[model samples]
Target: MTQLETAMAILMKVFDTYAAGEGKPDTLTKGEAKTLLEKELPGLLKAAKNQEEVDKMLKGLDFNGDSEVDFSEFVVLVAALTCACHNRCVKK
Candidate 1:
């Protein structure tokens, strides 16, 4: 597979792995989201400065107000982070 294809596959796998933990298998509950962020993006969580900030981030990610994150929402989070990192690197 191409690099982008591999990345997409990895994203799906990661979401599936975490989403399978509890609740519906297709979406992430708050607890599952927290675990996924804590384990998968520890650096991002650490940079948040406080638990409230992290909570706010999670709330923002739930764009549909469904109290859970579906795959599309998760992709937005990943894409936003990727953009932020890319911008930072480009500025240097």
Candidate 2:
């Protein structure tokens, strides 16, 4: 597969793995989401100045106000982070 295709697959797989942890298999409960954050995106949590900031990040992910993160919400987080990193690197 192409690089983009591989990335897409990985994203779906990561979301699926975490979402299956609790509650519905198609969406992530807050606890499951937190676990995914801590494990899959440890650097992001480390970069956060404190737990408040991390909480805010997680809150921001639930765009639909449904108290859970679906695949689209997860993808938005990934895309936003990708853009932020790319912009920072390009500015260097």
Which predicted model would earn the best lDDT? 1
lDDT of 1: 0.96
* lDDT on C-alpha atoms for all candidate structures: 0.96, 0.93
- My TM-score estimates for the predictions, one after another, are 0.96, 0.94
Q: What is the total number of backbone clashes in candidate 2?
A: 0
Candidate 1 RMSD computed on C-alpha atoms after optimal superposition onto the true structure: 1.0
lDDT of 1 by residue, 31-90 (tens): 999999999999999899899999999999899999999999999999999999999899
Tens digits of per-residue lDDT, candidate 2, 1-92, equal: 99999999999999999999889999998889899999988998998999989888888899999999999999999999999989989953
Superposed Cα deviation of residue 33, candidate 1 (Å): 0.5
Cα-based lDDT at residue 42, candidate 1: 92
Model 1: per-residue Cα lDDT at residue 1? 100
Model 2, 21: alpha-carbon shift in Å? Answer: 0.4
Question: Once model 2 is optimally superposed onto the true structure by TM-score, how far is the C-alpha of residue 1 displaced, in angstroms?
Answer: 1.1
